[model samples]
Target: MKTIRSRSDRWFDAVNNVLIAAVGLICLLPFLHVLAKSLSNQASVMGNKITFYPIGMHVEAFRFVFAHTRFFEALQVTLLVTVIGTVLSLTITILAAYPLSKPEFKGRKPILLLYVFSMLFYGGIIPGYILMKALGLLDTIWAMIVPLLVVPFNLFVCKTFFEGIPESIEESAKIDGATNFRILWSIVLPLSLPVIATLGIFYAVGYWNNYFHPLIYISSVDLKPLQLFLYETIANTEELLQEQPDSVRLSMAPEGFRAATVISSIVPILLVYPFLQRYFVTGMTLGSVKG
Candidate 1:
């Protein structure tokens, strides 16, 4: 039997499509503007003539940013922290989540409550900074990685996915004389790639974009991440310009410089997304679905 769509159904579909397109454009337009401004000639950028496309196209801003030694150092620091932190965070989250997913585990509920409580009630930045200072993590890369080893929300997402796994699979592994650790390593983890990829990206993106923790804990210029560098670049542009000779400052485009720096900082992680794109939707669905 052929099913006929109702008029109201068609109207609702049209409205939903329009709203989704609108939302996408809202998010996309700002990035387009930044890209256009970055690529545009200094005069066009300064005159605010650049919009979604480059006006009097030029790559001078990109050239200047790439040549900057400080920018490269910050980029290296950010890449290091993001990779190391994401790996550590995922490892810890998996260790904790797997145990909590098992209903037979004693005190699981209490442990879960503690994790949830920490998420809801965190000590403010001052306390966190003081703790980092006391631990001698201040002004170090460890300060960026250690303080955010695990996120409770991500832990719960992994736990939910684990809980959904059929017990029969583990039982079969047990019959084969597999230990708990062996089961987790060889069996459970192999089956949980979707959630792993999802959480990995989540952790990676968080560490990559982190500026607040860096701002508070890291005082050393050498330890600053790309985000802090970008912030300082824009924030100090005017002061830097004032310090420069009038001819040099007049020739430079501060807005274009800032935009190019922003793009460069974000481009690496953005490139990484497409490789993990296939797993993302599946991971979110499986990890979030709770019975």
Candidate 2:
């Protein structure tokens, strides 16, 4: 009977749903554990007593971070870098990718090869450091972003996406007397939102999480980004061993503060993620099939 068949289908769907939910929870459990550990008491954390839920719920860790002298300032620096760096990287990447996407463009192959070559073989860190030093980017915010602006992987993906667009559509736009720039701004971009949003999230997250560049290039305390500041606080365990007065060392649990910093770092990512969630899914399947 048709009714029996419908019931069977519903049961299959329910089973699949349960499987998916179980997998989702499995993947999420680690992050949840970290969050719980971060809010739990330092003593509990030190004793290896905390699990997926807070033990002896405490506010010291969050309080310690909030009271840090450079916390807010570093946060602002990181925000500025994320916003400005994402915009610049997006602009340069699109301009580069769009031209490369057009086969008719002379020497496109060579340019693309050059981009790909860098990915396979990179100049080692010493040379890169020398180049940055020569550029006078040391001790500057530009040091963090300028070096990593155009990622070759993202560039290739964008170029591939653009190439996947039907040439006939572009031809029609051209026939309508729309200039290439105009067409890009008015038409191509609107359709390319999926990839753009995905790339924006990539760039934003990259910029937000970058710390080593600042550590190496920036010596000025005021110029350091939030990640570097947090790293200095949490990752450098030697500080805890220093024979400093108890008054100087706050009672905040190091583990909890680390958690708070991680949480703080993830907030922007979380905020931007919802907007890009649709695009992220769409971009992954951008050209997987042609219809």
Candidate 3:
């Protein structure tokens, strides 16, 4: 059987499509403008002639940024933190969530309540810094990695997904003489790829874009991440321009340099999304369905 739409339904569909397209354009246009500025010649960029398209296009800004040694150092630091932090966070989240998902686990409610409570409250920046200092983590990469290993939200999502898995599979594995670790490693995790990828990207993005923790705990220039480096670059562009040779300054505008750095910093993370896009929606949907 086929159902026909009324005139009002057609009107509503048209309006919804228009609104969604408008919102998409709003998010996309600003990025296009930045990309234009990065590629536009210094004269066009300074004169505000660039918009969604480049005017008198050139790649000098990218060239200048690529030649910067400090940028590479900061990139190295951010990469290290993002990779290590994501792996450790996913490992801890899975470990903690697995036990909590099982009803037979003792004291599960109280432990879960503690996690939720901590999520809703914080000890403030001063105490966090003091704790990092006391632990000898200040000025080290561990300061960034250790403090954020377990996000309550991710833990809950993993727990919900684990609970959705059929108990029959685990029981079958046990019948084959498999231990708990073997069941999780060989049976459960293999079936939980969607949720794992989802949480993996979440942890990766948080660590990559994290700025406040590094600002508080890291005092050494060598340990600064890409976001902090970009901040300092934008904040001190005038001083940087003065330091550069006259010929170099003439070839690149301050705004162009900033735009180039912004694009460069984000492109790597953006590249990661497409590969995981297939699993993202499925993971979030299935993970939330049970709870």
Candidate 4:
């Protein structure tokens, strides 16, 4: 059946669409400006002639970024952390959440309360650094991966989603002499793909964009992640540009190099997001609304 909309409804829809489009454009404009600056000629960039579009297009900025050895090293470190961290986090979260989702599980309430409490309160930065130091995780890649393995909010979200699963499905599996682990592995996980994908993206993005923990824990230049590398590049653009070969320095402006670094750091997450976006809303809504 087609529903008829009143004139006011039409006006409201028009206004809402216009407002949303304006907000999206507002957010997108800065990124476009950065992209333009990265591609524009040094003279065009220095003269403030570049806007949303490149005034004098060139790939020199990108070529310089790609040729930098530190850029690849940081990229490699970030990729390792993101991939390994997401997998480990999802495993730990699923294991913890599964037992908590079951009302019959022993000490569920206390354990859950602890998670919630920790979520609400945190030890300060110094305490966190001390803890990492004590654990011998300082200056190691594990320093970045271990500390964020189980986010309380993500735990609760997973637990709630698990609770929403119908009990009858598990009972049928049990009647067939399937073990709890078997049920979870063969049935529960397969059915929970949306939530998994949603949480995977969350974990991946967190690991990818993390800077503070790495800044404190990672003293070694070799272990610094992409975000930290990008920060240093932007903060010391003039020095970094001067260090570059004269050909590179002549080919790209400091602003162009900074813009290129920014773009390079964000591209991985941008590429990954669209693939998982279909599941993101569904998982978040179902996981959040159930309990």
Return the top candidate by lDDT. 3
Per-model CA lDDT versus the true structure: 0.88, 0.81, 0.90, 0.90
Question: Candidate 1's residue-wise lDDT over 1-291, tens digit each?
Answer: 988999999999999999999999999999999998888888998888888999877787777677743889999999999999999999999999999999999999899999999999989888988898899888899999998899999899999999988999999999999999999999999998878988998898889989989998888899999999999988887676567566656766899878888888878878888897876676557677764
Which candidate number would show the highest TM-score if scored against the true structure?
4
Q: Model 4 segments beyond 4 Å from truth?
A: none
lDDT of 4 by residue, 1-291 (tens): 999999999999999999999999999999999999988998998888888999878778888888864899999999999999999999999999999999999999999999989998999999998989899999999999999999998888889999989999999999999999999999999988878888888898899989988888999999999999998889988887888778878878889888888888888778877777776676557687773
| Tens-digit lDDT track of model 2 for 1-291 | 445568888999999999999999998888888788778877788788877899888766666556644678898999999899999999999999999988899999899899989899988878888999899888888998997799998888788888888889889999999999998898889988878988887788789888778888888988889888877767764364244446535455667767766766666667767776776677676644432
> TM-score order of candidates, best first?
4, 3, 1, 2
Instruction: Rate residue 238 of model 4 by lDDT.
Output: 89
Report, for all candidates in order, the number of backbone clashes: 0, 0, 0, 0
TM-score of each: 0.92, 0.83, 0.94, 0.96
Each candidate: RMSD: 2.1, 3.4, 1.7, 1.4
TM-score of 1: 0.92
How far out, in Å, is residue 270 in model 1?
A: 2.3
For model 2, the superposed segments whose C-alpha errors exceed 4 Å read 1-23, 237-251, 287-291
Which 10-residue window of candidate 1 scores lowest in summed lDDT?
240-249
| Whole-structure CA lDDT of model 2 | 0.81
The pairs that clash in candidate 1 are none
